[model samples]
Structure formats: structure tokens, C-alpha cells
Target: MRDTNFLIENNAKAIWHPMAHPADMRARPPKVMMRGSGVHVSDIEGRTLLDAVAGLWNVNLGYSCDPIKRAISEQMDALPYYSGFRGTSTGPSIQLAYELAEWFEPEGMVRSFFTSGGSDSVETALRLARQYWKIKGQSDRTKFLALKRGYHGTHFGAASVNGNANFRRNYEPLLPGVFHIPAPWTYRNPFNETDPAKLAELCAAALADEIEFQGGDTIAAFIMEPVLGAGGVIVPHESFMKLVREICDKHGILMISDEVVTGFGRTGAWSGARLWGVKPDMMTIAKAITSGYFPLGATLIGEKMAEVFEADKSGLASIGHGYTYSGHPVGCAAGIAALAETRRLRLNENAAARGSELRQALLALQSRHPIVGDVRGQGLMAALELVEDQTTKKPLDKAKMADVAAATYEADVMIRVSGNNIILSPPLIVSAADVEKIAVALDVGLLSAV
Candidate 1:
């Protein structure tokens, strides 16, 4: 067995984790994961911990999945890599696209374009929105809008369109012409109303006003997460999404749903867009697409937008798009297997069932812990907003919350905290019992911190 000190030292010397301060991390020397199985992971010391965030909101099939492994192995042996250019395609790439198009039908129009990951896929959507409007003879429509606190990804275009302060603030002067409006967070409603309908109107009207102020002709599209994942797992009011859809339609703005975190059974449906019955003009998907078994993301376009490209078939006007590893064979194979596994096991139904149990348990904790300001979510994705006072709904100290989150990791339950809110997005394969253990671990950590 490898020496524990050696492993920790090596990781500290070489590896850099996302969203972590390297200096402070050296003192703790990050937990080195040796292996994972089902909903648990083992460190170098053979200590097991329940995986609550599902490996950064992917790994929907849990760890050590045999089917996905076999599928990937078979494809790698046959043809591991290929380009989707010049009329060439691989088996898994073709099959998975067709399957997903069929699955997400009736709610959103569809056609798939592959990328290496979520950020790239989101960039593709933003660029496509501009190009589609151009093809429709509306070249002035170049501006893009997203909700505040929304996290699309880290790429230039995606980051610009994303509304996360920390993600964009450091990297200033992001892509020009991107705008942001208030998110539909009912808990701390900007409208100062508790009613869902009023809150929905308040949020959608904010977007409408922004579009009008900027001149509708200059705005290309509006992108948003159906259930704000990284942004505190904020679920929109009941009628909010529909109103957003109506506003987009009225202004001829293409709707791009960034379902990177909420897609593929995360919200007890094939896509959260389907759960809410919102017909987006386009979709950017990743995460559970391959259950984190491989790096893959896709941009799904509506039929109306596809026709614009279809009409430009004359090879004269260029579409200037594509990644070197666009339709990777192994990633596609993993995606196919992941989708098949999710369907066969009825993972969406499981998420809804387990999520219901999680809600009740979390709400019960609210009665006991004032630090848990609010509990909100749908299906398997959820959040516990930590607060200083329950009555005033004052958020806990940001640094203190981060400390609590870091401590929870030591407790052997990997839960993520976004801006004072403990975000829990376990794998779709997570069982009811696993949910209970995760919640209990979180409670212990929070109480200890308080």
C-alpha cells in the first residue's frame, strides 16, 4: 500500500482542485480517493464516505458501474476516437443522439451536436443562437441574456452569459453583449411577495423590461437553468417558466435551456424542461449524459433553428463550428450505456421517490436547526440554505459556511455548499437509506459548526 503521507504530499504538490484555495488546501492536504463503489468512496486510509454531491453532480449511475465500463471497453476496442466531420460518424454517437432526440421529444424540438463538456456545449449554444438569428435575417440579434446566479460554464461565451459573480468577476470583460436579470428565487423574492404567481410575473417581467430596454432586435436569446443548480438549487415558482417561455416567444427570442445539471433524470424526468412542460428552442446538456464516466456534452437544437442551417446547404455560407474530438466514440458509448441504465432501472421514478423522502427529512431538520433557513428542491437535486436567523432569513457568514462545508467532507459525506447554502445533488442511483445517512451527516456537521 502507498504511504498516506506520500499520497497527500504528492497531491498537494501537483494537483489543483477547482474552487479551492491552494494555500489553505495544503494544510488539509485534500482527501485522496482510492476507489468508489455504489454511493460510497474510499480514501487512501481505506476510510469510506457517502458521496452526496455525486462527483460534481455527475456520476448518475454511481461508481464502478459494470455496464458503462463494458460499453466503453467494447467501443475502445472497436474504435476509440473519430471525427464527426465530412459525413463521418461512429456507432455510439449516432445511436445515443437518436435515442435522446426521441426521449426529449414533444416538449422541446431536437437535433444533437456534441462537444467535450458542458462549458463547450454551452458556448456552442450561444454561438448557434447568434448564427441562427443571422440566418433568419436578423443579424442585429447578437445579445444574450441569462438569470443572475446562473452558472452555465467557464468558457468565454458561457462565462459571459452566466450570471455567477465569482465565476465572471475575476475574468473581466467577458464576451460582449451578454446581459443578466434576476433569477426566480421565491424564498428571498425580489418582488417582496410570497405568492408564487406574483413572483413569477415579477421575474418574467424583469426579463421583458431588459429586452425592451436593450431593443428586442439586439437580443439573440435567453438561457437559464430549469432548477438553478450551482446557484443554491433555486427552483422557480410554479408558473414562472411558462411565463418566461411566453415572453421569449413574444419577442422572437430563442430560448436555450442550460440543463447541464438538471438533465438526464436529475429531476425525475428525462429533462427538467419536460418536468415543467417548457418548450425551449435549444438545450445544452452534460453531467449525467455519460454519468461522469467520460467527458461529453451536447447542444440540442429545435427544428425551427435546424431549418436555418438546412437552407444554407450551398457550401458558400460557412457555419464555422466543431471541436477536434466532437463525437468521441468512448464518450458516446458511455452516454448510450448511461441512458440505457437510467431507463431500464426507472431512475427518474427512483429520484422522485427518494427526493420526496429527502424533502421530509430536511424539512424536519429545519424545525430543529435555525441554521437551515430554507429547504427547496425537486427530485434528487436539493439545497438547505443556511441562515443566521430563521425569522429574518439572514444568510450565514460566507466564510463560516465554507468552513462547515469543508468540515462535512471530513465527516465522510461529500456535500457542496454554494454561497452559504448546502447543495445536495446525489447520484440518481442513490437509495433512500443513503439519503438519510447523508442528511444526518450534514446535520451533525452543521450543528457542530454552529
Candidate 2:
């Protein structure tokens, strides 16, 4: 076994963790996860816990996915890396693009632009949106609109478009001309609306108003997550996405779906766009593309946008933006294998079944624990919003939420805590028993918090 103490000591001194205070890591050392298999991960101390967060909501196929591992190994031995830039590309990358084109065909996506990860994918999509507008002779369409509490990753462009203040506050002076409208969160809203359908209409109207206020001719796109994941798994009303799509279409605004979390069956559909029967002009996809086995992402272009770019007589259609590892062969190989496994296992159906069980379990927990202010999610992605008072909906203290997360970890389950929200997103392949196990662990943690 590795020297746990030595590893922890060095890690504390050497590494600066993301989304965390540097001093906090030294004060309370982070868990040293040594290995993972299936939906369980083992720490350096040999304590195994059910990974409810699914490695940051990416590992849809879990850790012990041999097919993905084998594909990566075979690719590494053959041709590990190749630049898919300037007319140079590898066989695996080309094949993977073809596969993704087929996979996302239902969503009207006809072409794919590869990236290194989710942030890159978001950046690619945002840049492409502007480029598309410019190609169509709408050079003034440089502004972007998005929903509040939506996460688009941490890149400069993505962060600028991100709706969450926590992500944008520290990195001020973000890209100018990006506006945000209130999200369709029924639990709490400026309108004090309780009815989900009515709230969705109101939010849609808000989007329309924002577009008009900004001038539709000046706005390039309206970007959003179909179901907000990092923002506490805030699932919008059933019609919210469709309404947004309609508004975007009416305004001549490109709709960019940041499906980094909601893509690849996490939302019980092949893509979150399909979940609401709305086809976006562009979609940003990553995370579960290779089930977190390989870091890869893609910005999928719809037929409408592809046709414009492809038919452009001007040389402006040539995209100058691309990563050095744009289409790494190993990542593509892993993606190919992961996609096959995802289909073979029929994980989307399981996600729907297990997600239903999880939602029911969480709702029951809400009944039993007054601290659980709300339970919201779709498919396997879910969150329990804790509160100090049920009537007032007062949020629980952040420290107390941390304690609850610690208790859950001690109870042998790994969950993600964002503020007072305890997020759970197990692998799509999770069994019924796994759902129960997660519920039981959270029950213990909730009891401790109480």
C-alpha cells in the first residue's frame, strides 16, 4: 500500500485544489482517493464509499469499465496523439466524430468540433456562435444571454456566460455584453410563483424581454443548461426549455445548450435537448463522453449552422480556433468504446428507473426531515436543499452542511455539497440496491444534521 501519511502531507503542501481555499486543505486534509471500481471509490486508508457524485458527474459507466480501458490502451499503443488541425487528423478521431454525428443526429447536430474537456467545449460553442453570426453578415451580434444559476465552466468566455455569481465574482471583468435572465426555478423566484407551468411562462417572457431590451440583432446566442446541474440540480418546469427555444428562434438568436452535465443519458434522454423536444442550434458536450475515462469534449453544430458554415463562399468559414489536443486519438478511442458500452448497457433506461426511485426516496426524506427544504433533479442527477426552517425556507449554515457531508462520507457514501445543497449523481448503471444504499447513507447524514 502507498504511504498514506506521506502522500497526504505532500499533497497539502504541493497542490492547490480548485474551488477550495488553500488554507482549508491544510487545516482539514482532503480525502485521498486511491482507486475506484464500479460506483465505489477507495481512499488511501482503504475506506470504500459509494461514489454518489460519480466523479464530478462524469463517470456514467463507472470506474471498472474494461471496454473503455482496453480501447485507450490499444490506441496508446497504436497512435496515441495526433493533431486534428489544418486538414491533419487521425483515423480514430475521424471515426469518433462520425459516431458523435450519429449519436447527436436526433438533436439536429450534423457536425462535431472536438475539444479537450467541458470548458473547452463551452468556449468552442460560444466562439462558434459569434462566428456563425458574423458569417451570416450579422457582425453586430456579439452579445450573449443566459439563465441565472447556470454553469458553463471556468474558461474566460464560459465564465463570462456563466450565470452563477460564485464562479464569476472572483474573476471579474469577464467578457462584456453577456446578459442573464432569472432561471425557471420554481422553489424560489422573483415572481413568487409556485405553479411550475406559470413560472415557466413568466421566465420565458423574461427571456423575451431581455432579448428585446438588448435588441435581438445585437445578441448572438442564448446559452443554457437544459437542467442546471452544478447550480444544485435545479430542474426547470417541463416547458421551460421549449419556451426558451421558441423565444430564441423568434429573436433570430442562436440557442446553445451547455449539455456538459445533462448530455449522454444523465437526463434520461440521449441528450437533454431531446428531453424537452427542442433542438438547439449548438450543443456543448463533455464529461460522460468517455464516461470520464478520457478527457474529451465536443461542440456539436446543428444542420442549420453547419450548412451556413459549409456553404460560405468567403474564407471566413475556416475556423482558426482549435486545441493542440483537439482530437487526441486515445480520447476518441475511449469515447468510441464508452459510447458502445453506453448503448449495450442501455444506461439511459436504467437512469430513468433509478432516478425515479431516487426522487421518490428524496421526497420521502423531505417528509421525514424538516431540514430538507427541497428535492429537485431529473434522471440520476439530484440534490437535497437543506434549510434551517421549513416555513421560511431559510438556508442551513454552510458549516452545518459541511458537517452533514462529512457524516455522509463517514457513513460510507460520497456526495457533493454546494452550499446547503447535497448533490447526488451516481453512475447511470447504478442498481436499485445502490439507490437504496445512497438513500440510507443520506438518511444517516440528515439525522446527524438534525
Q: Judged by TM-score, which candidate is best?
A: 2
Output the lDDT of residue 279, model 1.
Answer: 90
Off by over 4 Å in 2: none
Measured by lDDT, the strongest candidate is: 2
lDDT of 2 by residue, 186-284 (tens): 887899998999999999999999888999999999999999989889888889999998888898999999999999899899888999999999999
TM-score per candidate:
0.96, 0.99
lDDT of 1: 0.86
**Candidate 1 local lDDT, 221-302, one digit each (tens):** 9999999988888888768788889999999999998889888888887787888889999999988988999999999988
Error of 1 at 333 (Å): 0.7
